[model samples]
Target chain A: MPENKDYLNYIDRTAPKSPLLKNALLAFLIGGLICVIGQLIGDFYQKICGLETDSMRTAVSVTMVFLGALLTGLDLYPKIAKHAGAGTIVPITGFANAITSPAMEFKREGLVLGMSAKMFVVAGPVLVYGISSSVVVGIIYFLYKVLIGG
Target chain B: MATRLGNQTIALDKSVSIINTATVVGTKESEGPLSPFFDVKMKDAEWGEETWEKTESKMQKEAAKLAIQKSGKTADDIDCAFAGDLLNQCISSGFSARELGIPYYGLYGACSTMIESLSLGALAIDGGGMDTALAVASSHFCTAERQYRNPLEYGGQRPPTAQWTVTGAAAAVLENGGAGPYVTHVTSGKVVDFGVIDQNNMGGAMAPAAIDTLCAHFSDTGRSPESYDLILTGDLGRIGREIVINMMNSSGYNMNDNYGDSGCMIYDIEKQDVHAGGSGCGCIAVTACGYIFRQLKDGKLNNVLILGTGALLSPTSSLQGESVPGIAHAITLSNKPGGEG
Candidate 1:
C-alpha cells in the first residue's frame, strides 16, 4: 500500500515465511503430540472409571468439549495455534485450549467470578454455535433412533 | 595509548549527578499509520516523522538536557560524543546530537540499543574512544505500532501478547574524564537465540534469550550475579521481568537485592495511562542513560549489570505464522579503575 514511500511505509513486513511443506510437517509433529496427550487422558479415564472403550468414547467426547473449553480460557490456544496453525485450531482442541488460556490467565481474580463469568469474552459466539449445532445434531439422532426402534 | 585530543581530563572530580528526570506523551491528535486500512477513515496521524520525531526528539533532547544538568558538564566543553537510537537511520539520537552539533555515532539493537550503546560508550571512555558517550532510544506509539501491529486508530482489538510501545526517549552521557563512578568496565554480549518463534508476547518470547546472553556474559567474564550492585534488563515489561526472575531463581542466583527492569520504570501505572508498562529501546535507555548513569556517577549505585532484551521480529513472520526468535546483550559498568582517580 505504501508503494515506494520510504519512511511513510513503516509496516513490518520482514517476518520469515516457512514453506508450506515445513509448516505442514511442524503441524503434524505438534498435532500428533497433542493427540498423544488426548490418548493418555482417555486411557486414564477408562482405567479409573471402569468404563468400556466404547462407553468411554462418549465420555471422551464430552471431556474433549470441556477440555477444549478449558484450554480456550487458558490463553494457550494461541501458542498452540501458532505452532499447529489451522490443524489444531479446526479441531475441538483449539476451542478448549482457547477458553482455558484466558480463563486460567484471569483466574487470579477469582475462578468463579472472573474466569467462569467473562472467560468467553472473545470466543462466546463460537461456543454458542458449537453448542447449538450439537443440540440440533442430537435431536436428529434422537428422531432417527425413534423411527428405527427395534 | 596516545590521545589525539589529549587524555580525557576530568573537569570536575564529582561531576554529573541526577538532578531531576521527567517524560511526556503525545495526545490523540498524533495517531495514524494504519488508519486507512484499519479504520477506512483517517482518525489521526500517529506514525509520521513529525509525530515520531516530535516525541523522539523531545525525549532525547530533554534527556540530554537533564544529563547535562545532572552531570554538571558544560555543554560547550563536551568533546566528542558516542550516541545511539532505535530508528532505522537513528533519527531521534541523530536529531538530538545534530541539534547540539557534537561529534556523535549512531547505533541500533531494537530495544537493546541503549545498553549496547552505553556499554560501548563506557568502554570508549575507559579505553579512550571518546571524551563522553551518550546512549539513547525512542519509539513513537504509531510508528512502532505500524511496524509491529495494524495501527492505533485501526480500532482492531489486540491480543494479550501485545505490548504498548511508549512514545518516549531516554539518554545518558558517560564522560571519559568524569568521577570515579565513571564506567569501569564494559564487557561485550553474544547474540544468542533460544528458538522461540512466537513473537506475540515478546516478554516470554525474549526471556530465554536474555537469560542466555546474561549467562554467557557472566560466564565469559568469570563473574557471578552477586558481584554487581544491580542486574537490570531493558524493556522486558512485566511478564518478561517475571520470566527473568523465575529463570534466575531456578538458576539459584538471586538478583532481587538490586534487580530491576526499564519496562517497569516508566510511568506510574496507577496514575499514568500506560496500559501494561513500557517496552521500547528508550525505556531502559532513559533510565540508565538518564537516571542510573547519574546514580552511578554519584556513587549511589557502585556497580550495574545492564542486560538489554530484544525480540527479533519482522512484520512478515508474524503475519505468516512463524515463531519470533529473541536476543539480549549484557554489559557491566562499574567505577573501579586500573588508574587512580
Candidate 2:
C-alpha cells in the first residue's frame, strides 16, 4: 500500500486555518483597553488625590492587581481571557491573574505550601529574570561610568 | 482464537473484559463537564497530604481501591497491577502499589499510560498469565507542573496553545471470563517524530503519531472509520484533533463523524479557561473510566477505538532542544459476549 508520504508535507496540508489578522486585531484592541484602564486609574489618583507621578503609577498598579485577583475569584476573568486572548494576558492584569488563579486553585492544599508556595508558579520566572537582568544592566552601566570617567 | 493481523495489531485469544473502573479528580476537574460521572471528586486537591506529590499518590491509591471494590474483588483477587503517572521515578504509581499491595508493573508512556496499561492488562489475561489484572494511571496538575514545566512559585504565563494538566486518576479492572466491555484488539504504536520542538503545543507534537496509528490500525484490520461507533484520541486537545482529522481525510479515511478527543471532552473550552483543553495521563484515564466506560456498559456503544497518545519528552530533552517524539496505543472494545463487532 502507499503508506509512504512526506510528513512535513502532510502537516502543512492539514493544519487548521488560523485567522491571524482578526486574532491580532482583537489582541491589540483588548490590550490597548487594559492600558487605557491603567492610565485612567493613574489619572484619577494624580488629579483627584494630588499624588505624584511615581506614587500615582504605583497606586494604579496596585489597584489593577487587586481588580484582577477579585475578578479571577469571581470566575469572571477567564471569560474575558477567552475572548481577549493575549490582550488580557499582556498587561499587568495578566500578571495579577497568573498569581491569583494558581493560588486560588491550590488553596485546598494548604496556606503555606499550597497558596503561598504556588503563588509564584506563574510570576516567579518574571521576578527572577526581571531582577537578574536589571542587575546585569546595572553592572554594565557601572563599568561604562568607571571606564569613561563620566 | 488469537491472530496477529499485521506488524502491530494483536487480536486477543481470550475475551478480556473491563469488569470495573473508577475515577478520582481534583476540584478543577470536578467543575468540568464530566464531574458527575467521576467516581470520587476530592473536596480538596490535597486530600490532607502534606505536599502535592503525595496528594497525587493518594489519588492513585484511592482510585485503584475504588475500582477494586467496585469489581467486588479484594486486592488479593488482582493478579497484578499495571500503572504509571507523570511523576519522577513513577512515584505516584509506585506509592499507589504500596497501598494496593498487588504485584505491580510500572510503565511510562507519558499521557498514553492509561491505554498502555489497559492494553497490557488485557494481553496478560489473554496470555493466561492472570485471571484478573488492574490497569491504573494518574496525574496531578500541581505536581506535574512542578516536575515537568515549572515550580509552583515560577508563576509562568501559559501560552494560548498550552493545555491544562488534568489532576485526576483512573483505574480499570480487566478480568477474564467476566461480563463488561471486552477488549478485543490492540495496536501498539511506534514512536514518530515530526521534529516539532515546541513543548507548549503537545497536541501538535502528538497528532502525527495519532494519524500514523489510526492509519495503521485501519489498514491492518481492514476496517474503516464507519466500523467503530466512536474513535477517541487520548489528549490531543482541540488543535491536534483538527490536525488529525485533516490528516485522516487526506489519507483517504474521513473520520469526521466518529472521531473525538478526550482532552476536548473533559471541559467546556469556551466557559472554562483551559486553553487547548486537558492533557495528562489522567485526562484520558478519567474520561474513559468516567464517561466512555459508562456508555459501553449501558450498551450505548458496542464498538469503540481508544487511541492513547503521548508526547515522549523530558524536561532535559526539551531544554537540550530535542524534538518531541509522539506515540499512540490503540485498543478496541466491544460489549458483545464473543467480542463480536
Which residue ranges in model 2 land beyond 4 Å of their true spot? A1-150, B151-156
Per-residue lDDT over B129-165 for candidate 2, one digit per residue giving the tens place of the 0 to 100 score: 7999999999998889867774443223466668999
**RMSD vs true structure, all candidates:** 16.7, 4.9
lDDT of 1 by residue, B1-341 (tens): 42121121111222222222333234321231211111111123332434545556656666666556655665664555555655556777777787776667777777777667666665555555456655556665655764565322221223343566755555565665544554443444444444445555677667767877666655545567778778888777766777777677878767667778767665553344344456777566555654565567578877777877776667776767656566676665566642122
Q: Pick the candidate with the highest lDDT.
A: 2
All DockQ scores: 0.02, 0.12
**Clash count list over all predictions:** 39, 12
Give TM-score values for chain A, per-prediction: 0.54, 0.89
Residue B251 Cα positional deviation in candidate 1, in Å, after optimal superposition: 3.2
Each model's C-alpha lDDT? Answer: 0.58, 0.88
Which lDDT value does model 2 have at B243? 87
